[model samples]
Target: MASQPLDPGNSGRNDPALLRLPSTVRHRIYLFLGVARWDGCPLLFDLDGPVSPSDQVTFYGLLLSCRAVYTEVSALLFSSNRFVIHYRNKRSLQPLRNLTPPSLAALTSLKVVLNQASCHHRREAEASGACCTRVSGCFTRKPKGAGGHCLIRRPHKNLHDTPLQSSDPSARLMLEEWRATAVYLSSNTKLDALELSLVCDVDQKEVEAAEHVVAPLLLFPKLKDCHVRLCISPNSHLRQLARNASRQASSNPALEPASPTSGSSRLLITLPREVRIRILEYTDLVAPLKEVMWNRLGLGYHYFSSGCSAWEGVPCLPPYHHGCQYRDCHGQGIIKDGIVRSDQLRSIGCFCGVRHAAFSSTCKCWAPPTPLFLICWDLCEDARFVFFSANRFVVSDSLVSANPWLAYDVSFTPDPKWLLENRSNYSWMEWYRQAQPPRAYPAHRFAATKFLREVVPADYLGYLRFLELVFPPYNHECWPHDGHPALQDWIDTVDWVKDKINAPAITLRLVMAGSRMWHPACPDDRGGLTRVQGIAVLTGYNRILKPLAVLREHGLTRFYADFAWPWKWTNRVYERLRAADDPNTILSWLEGQETLLNDRAERLILGEDQHDRLRSNEAKPGPSPWKMHSGREY
Candidate 1:
């Protein structure tokens, strides 16, 4: 075989002088000769044998040109490019098995594309020693017999004449063959990534079953990366049937057809730009100062919540209408046990009757919507710019000690019950401790903040219109013990934010939580100052609001008095003040004002009758009733 003359094109390439060139030149020439396709391009090794050598020549032509060239380039050919194997039957393994050790050693990544329809037919041919007679076009109409009878076409020889199994076999045999081949390949090569794709007809049920069997085999521990994709043929009968059903249904006037734009439209690129924006606006993408996650893994539903305990009891609310005002909650207040607590504060009323037991329990805590970025690059680009520009990203006070971006690095909190013995100690103080403290400790917040400022790309923040700094609620322990330290850290963070903002004109939201009213004072509480002590509440407000007023003086505009006990009253009294207004004005006015704290303290000092008389005199009217049938007021 070595002495014989090679094929026409193979003859001229057999020059011994080629080896005399510099190694670099030789490697470059070899690269051109060996690479069937560009790097990363799929070099498909069709399992169905080519009818002619010409098809094989397209991929392996240069290798057969000369011995020296083949020796030099084969390794580069295998290693530099990705190899794809199109599998149909047992015969698909032939090329992989035939690979020389050197070629196998050069291999780094392999992708296998399996066609279930072909595999099914191949299996049928193997079992019956022929193609299924029942299938249309399996036999030709041409007659070759003496009596002019039609003749049946013989099955391909590669299948080997064997009886097909009557039942659809679990992918065991197929998987076993693949496993053996995978083990052999692993032994021979330094494989980096293994990808397996299943292409099947539109029987979703059967495709899933086939995928379940074939997918796990791709996950060889030795492979550094693994991916499995399922592609259903457009010609799938099930899809055609579904389309037909939809057409038939649309023809019937009584059957109301759902609007095409009712849900998230997958063909966003195809839609007009305005339509896309309209659709995206409804998503959290455009929500202001709210945490939005795209492609989240938990809940599998659509909802939002202000971070609160999932297990907290529902608040008692008065009559409400879809478009009712915030003060629509009847003059009633938050009723705990049977006792009506202090008159319903607007801050508490904001969350009154709001429940998220279904979503919060399942959601991962503070997880970023990373999957949003995983879609097509164009869509990701469009969405990110729009999202960052439209909404103000908030780094709560706890997160301000460090960069906010770092928060995305933390995973969602798992169910405490799932932790078994590792769960937090739920003791006497646990309720009080958990209630006032930040859900995520400072360290996690710091990491998240760091990630936001440093890790998130500058372009994403280029159009940032707003940034919110939420002052975490202070419990009694947080206030007296750690208040100064927390306040100092927050002030430093505000300074950093002022200097770092990228936008020309950005609004800052300074959110103050109603820490005084966060925990209702318990009667069983002993000699320690009440959770809402007069001096402690006064000092905490002075500590928080003083710095906040400074930031406002420096031009931070949106002061969100979040969860303030008298949300309505507090907003009316304090939020309405000018940007440069003095913090002490409100502080001095509040000092003498009758509030829940003063009422509770006064009740203790005086008797119940005195407080009751005061409460009755100041009682607000209940929500207005619905109009009567005659259109007259009740």
Candidate 2:
């Protein structure tokens, strides 16, 4: 069957009724025609294949109705759907490179999947002059080793027998093509999202080649979201690069004009208080405030090397016997025959632990509206309240370690000259070995109250309505001891929150490890468990939960605690406790079971509520309530 020609004569002239409709209605029709919407599915276009007959009629047919319609709707066709270009070989990317300037500029979302096998195939084809015979302009001239005919190709038992080389002409050509396409996309398009997937054999050279090919595409300036998947180990570097590009894109000044207050928008103050608050809600001010990890690299390095004792011959005299106030070194008795250390003993800086925080939401579709807070005093107050009260503020164990007073101790700064002169034989590692705390000591202690008291401002704390504290998994052995520092820390934290903060609802989460039952009867261990082990496990959990039960009287209207134990183990534990003979054990088991069931019910209810909210938002029409600075609608 033959396809109809685009822009057939007199088609639009005959359709007077369609031309009489409003421009907005016509645009809506064009959008529907260009990308038909099916529930819960994304619009995707594969440029690697030919256009389907249905698309030719419903999409291109509409465009060909008239020159005016084609001019108006062509851009929408590229912008509305996500185009997927699979680069299998050099010829695979021709469709993308052939896009006109107008089409490229309108492109907003793209996904590119790179395959390395095509390069190998091309190389093999070139070796035997198989591709040369297919070239239209090629002259039939036999070369030295041709035997008066194109060389016959031999099949390899293993396709990857010949490894791809960086200097190979086919590989170089493919990379050059990729770089050009990336440059064009970056320069011509203001993309909302870009996804790159590298599919290749898990070899070092192939991974390097894939990285070089995708390097330029990762720098799309106006992208709001960027996703990169490398089918190889050690992809963290590439992932970090993509993250940096996304951050730069969001912060790009060209994405939006100056603050709304810069112009006559100063008149916005005349709006009603309710209206102003509603407007501010649309901005990032209402987004959740998250505690982000700070000084990650420095802390990671220090943590991994904390036990290193490279600095030997370090001695403690008089007050220095207990070591420096910063606790960088612990004084060990002198050994006479050790070499003097050259490096100065320095304290880890104040920014070692978590010291910086930000208002960050999980949504990557839009950047936060930060300038709104700087507009005026009244607006700032409103924005702060909206931010604190409307969305939950999350605190974790890392935030608890951000005590600047403890971090910066000036009582003891090591004197380099004195240390070198009075050098001891003891190495720093030996001192660390002696000073290191017991393994039983908890690595992370629950300190939500301490974090709020030390880091958050009193004004912001009072405005908070919802607070979520994520604690590290409770250690049964460390937490059961009443005199332990970990136990004391937990008590002090909850006590302080009860005394000071007035958040209406508090959510406590403990991420736990999954447990497995070991069968004593079977030679090959399976799921069945002995009664004694089960009882011990349940008792340990009970002891861990006993202290947290105090949260019920913390004065909050609602308090929810989630012990994220696997359902299989939780049910097994409950059954084991139920079979026990003691009445006290039965009562405790009932209480724990009730809590678990209630948590499950609450989760289902919350999920349904979220679903309802989404449906309501969808029914309301217009753009999403969340304000997007990029001028793109979700």
Per-residue lDDT tens digits of candidate 1, residues 133-170?
A: 21121111122211221122333334211211214463
Best by lDDT: 2
In model 2, what are the clashing residue pairs, if there are any?
309-429, 313-424
Model 2, range 1-634, lDDT digits (tens) per residue?
A: 9744333342464654555566666667865665534331235566755344543335767666776666567676666555666565234588888877777777655656553221112221222212111111111121222122231133222222123456667667767777787787677765554333223322333546645754674556646544343322223344333334334545333222325755534666777778888887776565422212111111210111111122365542322221122111111111122222322211111111011111111112222355676788877777777766665544434321221101111123335774576478534333322332222434344445455555556666666665544433222222235456655666666556555556334433332222232111111121344455444434434434455445445543343444323233344555765677774675565557645743543333234454345345533222111111112210
lDDT of 1 at 109: 51
Candidate 2 yields a Cα-based lDDT of 0.41
Task: Write down the lDDT of every candidate, Cα atoms only.
Answer: 0.38, 0.41
Model 1 residue 407 CA deviation in Å:
18
Model 1 off-target regions past 4 Å?
Answer: 1-279, 284-371, 376-378, 391-468, 480-489, 499-507, 515-555, 562-634
Q: Report lDDT (Cα) of residue 411, candidate 1.
A: 22
